[model samples]
Target: MEIRARGARRPYRSYRTLIAAACAALLGVLLTPAGAQGAPRGPHGAVKVSQPVYSYADSVRESVWVDTGLDGDADGVSDRVVADIIRPAEPARQGRKIPVIMDASPYYSCCGRGNESQRKTYDADGTPLSFPLHYDNYFVPRGYAFVAVDLAGTSRSDGCADVGGPSDVRSAKAVVDWLNGRGRAYTTRTGTTRVQAGWTNGRTGMIGKSYDGTIANGVAATGVRGLETIVPISAISSWYDYYFQQGAPLQGSGPDWLANYVESPAARARCQVVQRRLVDEAPRTGDVTALWEARDYVKNAGRVTASVFAVHGTQDLNVRTKHLGQWWDALADAGVERKIWLSQTGHVDPFDFRRAEWVDALHRWFDHYLLGYDNGIERAPMADIERAPGQWSTDRVWPPRGTDTTTLRPAQGPVAGVGTLGRTAARPGTTATFTDDPRLDEEDWAETADLNTPDKSGFVTRPLSHDLRLSGSSTVTVTATPSTETAHLSAVLVDLGPDTIRDYNAPGEGITTLTERTCWGPSTPTDSSCYRETAPRTADVTHTVLSRGWADLGTYASASHGRPLTPGTRYTLTIDLAATDHVVPAGHRLALIVAGTDRGLIQPPSTTPTLTLDLARTSAHLPLVGGARAFTRATTGAAPTDPAAGRSRPDGVAEPRRTPPIPGESG
Candidate 1:
């Protein structure tokens, strides 16, 4: 791939222009073409961007409402997604078409985005006076148009929010279509006047954090035209996974409640009927319904043509690591070009975690994808992962190819209650049972004790002889019989040892604000050029929960329907824990705890559940970064392998359900 140069090379004439431009830059005033008024053009006729070129104070700001053809609010008018555009005045006015960088978000008028939770500010005339964060202030002067859009039903948009459903996806997709002159938009909800994205080059890129980023993923899945690339930072790939994991309902409210909560009060009032419809569509069983399928980009990976740059936090309990890991795998299998940055921080943007490096990398990414500039980003490392807090490493591919999947089983320990995990399977008749307790929280479960009774079960391995890195999703398969009709089984992977690391889930953790600052882009008088410094908020932790998985026993056989388990009949339950990239030091121990009814994470059943595990058939398969040989060599002694390894039927039993293709797309 060659970098595209602007204009024809003119020897001495070009040299003189460059020298003159440099001299003017040192004087603090820039020289531009006779008709233009912003940044000066280069000798090759390209935008000459100095360090921090765009001034938010000087950029053009405007707004337009794009009609979405749906009367989501039932206000007798079609819904209109509001867009706030900021562009370099000179080039834009001079007819120099520029690529667009857009963020379609629902948080504009409410919870806000970024560390400071900045919201949209408006002038007296109802025009957007400020677009929060640094995109517009920094990128406009660099010859790009930065657009901040209000997802329909939020802020100034005229509609009802649908969470991650069709209305939400279409709100962003329409903007991309409009940029390419293929969609209809208007200046008002009921106005006859139409508006077109006349100044754009028709190529667009979408990016955001959280729900904003979720819009980008949803829009890209539509295979919409003009959407060239996307940078989804800690975004949700499947709304189903966001609310429910492996049939376990993680949160109390469903999409209907979420949709109403994100909308304006007026919108909620006007769209009450729509809200009811949403509630009717989203069931409480946590099944993967068609509603979720429509919102799942992972299911439509084949429809994607836009290149993806994914950023995620390994410790993000809100969206979790599996959301990105499973989506990334689908993108890879679909032959999508992609790059990723897997951080250790919890639900954070890279700009906060690694500012300077993030800005430089993002600049090159936009230049290559949106502006069609070849900046060698395509040749860079495919994955950058945090091995430990403040420590990072790069690899050609995520999870690193040829990873060894080591399956380990639980063996009764010398003590009555405690047990040991190793490569060897336990005796056929051995069993460990746990009763469900709806009152126990995650902290209670993490601090395992009271094993004399059956509220929970715990299994641990001896101190590792060598450092081991777990790099991908771990699968836990347990054969058991539940005493109750239904149960919610929770599986947790833990690092049991004394250590000091960032407590991502805790408020402020141990992070301290520093006096130093870093600049990302040009700032306007309102938004500054710099942000405060931040580092990991460390804490002394005796045991850290690395990953978790939950399964509703009723939905184990099929994710589409729920059925009570036969009273005394034993059944096989297999579930995949969230993915991770953590290094366990040589002296540390690894543990897996399986229990019922996690009170904090999900709504537990009213009646207690007693689960009796078939120790001979229960095993956890781990994706060790070290190959199988390395794991075996580091152990104290050789252990038995799975008797069903590589066979048509694992241990002579057939799969309960035609397991869906890893998360998204239908088989």
Candidate 2:
């Protein structure tokens, strides 16, 4: 094995090969049986056996408080995180030490996990009476302990919630430490009665969605000893990326609001200073400061010892695709054993996308990593991507292989300064300019089809002669200068097809509410593992936004500091569009839109700033399926425009389309 120092970058071409090899070696070492003597279904195939080793109907439900050392609220006492666990009864009597499945989140007592918003329930004695979600009811029967922990300062825990800061991560890390017998836990916040994880085998796996999943990502990056695997669904690998894209602020007053929102009212009051700190620490300039650096898991990817199974929707505008895509790339560089599921839904769980398939895959994933089961999951394909809505395909790796890095430059004469995209670049002196219009929404930027607006510049490619698939993030490099010292730059990739597609940003995104309900597992009176079904909502399509990117022109040179550009003193800025999987069919035009601002996700600037682009050096590089040679050669004799092509809509605006809901997801 290669023994390079941590954080050293490996050759990009060889890292993927090393990841495969390293996973094989790590599997045998990490998956060794804890204790497997005289059992019928020994450690080899523990998960494959028919009968469950433990009983789900009768399990021990309890809570413990773990010490996190720091009192973030500045109280007199140290912080304590609350952990609610459901485990097999009398594990010591059976001489069995079960593995643990934990979900550490801040939403337990407030807005619960999953679509149903199910929260935890407690008895008069303050002990947990029931756990939320199907995790405990499903996994506990299969010999795994399910733990739901309320991060410090949230729910019933002590201390102030610092959002995704060090306190947040340290709180979760302490729970893993306690499970592995390296940390302390008590029956109550300040109780003398101590508790130990004698029922566990010291192997734990974390799983959750959104904030819960973000905890898993943060804790796993600490390289906690007992954490064997993690399943982060639409999780944030970096809080900075969650709030900012490139150097552009995605929203205003996010950090302070989020910090207070997740904490209890009493904790929020006590931590008012901390809330103020959050606001004070936030950089209004959108630069990556030390605060953001501390929350970034990408820099600490090398420390991740646990295997990862990541899930995210490419069209998720909330958490966004970059959160998972960038983190997935980092894990690859770290040579960790990892798998990914890329869907088309917006911020929805895989359970809602493909329930049966999701459960089966998740079951095998835990069995192999948490339990010592040799289920052949390691040899399976690394990625399961939704090519289109509801259409799934498996590949050896993400973005697939054999993609061509195609460069398409802006050519003039299509519509004044707004031009068409082609193989050749426009002459050096030619330029396109636009002023930032905070009033315009994404729909407005998209609907300006006739190039009648001076607020944005648009470029398009003639109807394609054949299908072209974009499988990864596209880079937009432009040579330009802002009219002011500070300005925001927005770039968008578009599909000018005359077909309707899923509108992920819409409410429910086409999912209709149904009266009927479906159950996932056997349930007790306290908890029902079931939900209602939903269907898709549909609309007509004219043009679709594929991927987008943003940047603050002042911070174009560095993220730590901004360098004001002297007006017309050109600076080259390369912005990375979000990663995506899109197919532009035959006779559909591909477009690149350059604008000064995007109001849909960002706050409006106080003043308008104009941007001038030197079209000669400007180009958009896309990772096309057929590569440049194959695509360019294939279209050598093909005409740019097709006679059978459909015309624009009556209002020149393509109506928003909603995606029909597919079966298998619960409402």
User: Highest lDDT, which number?
Assistant: 2
Model 2, global lDDT: 0.73
- For model 1, what is the error of residue 467's alpha carbon versus the real structure, in angstroms, after optimal superposition? 1.3
lDDT tens digits by residue: candidate 2, 1-667: 0111122122111111000010000011112121222323444645353224565567888899998888887877888999998887857578889899999888887666665556888889987766776787667766888999898789999988877789989999999999999999999988879999999988999999887888899999999999999999988888887777777777555577777777888788788888887877777767777788888988899999999999987767667777887888789889999988877666777775566567667877898898877666766767777644555666666667777679999867655655878788898698888889987756677776425268888888766666667877788987786777667788888878676554565654433435555555445666665654444444567887888888777766786566666776788888878888776766777888888768756655545788788989899999887688745643445644662342221111122132334333332
lDDT of 1 at 322: 78
User: In model 2, where is the ten-residue run with the lowest total lDDT?
Assistant: 17-26
- Single out the weakest 10-residue window by summed lDDT for candidate 1: 13-22
Per-residue CA lDDT of model 1 for 216-253, tens digit only, reads: 98888888988889999988888888878777777767
Q: Assess candidate 1 and give its lDDT.
A: 0.72
Model 2 misplaced regions, further than 4 Å? 1-53, 414-418, 449-452, 633-667
lDDT of each: 0.72, 0.73
In model 2, state the lDDT of residue 567.
70
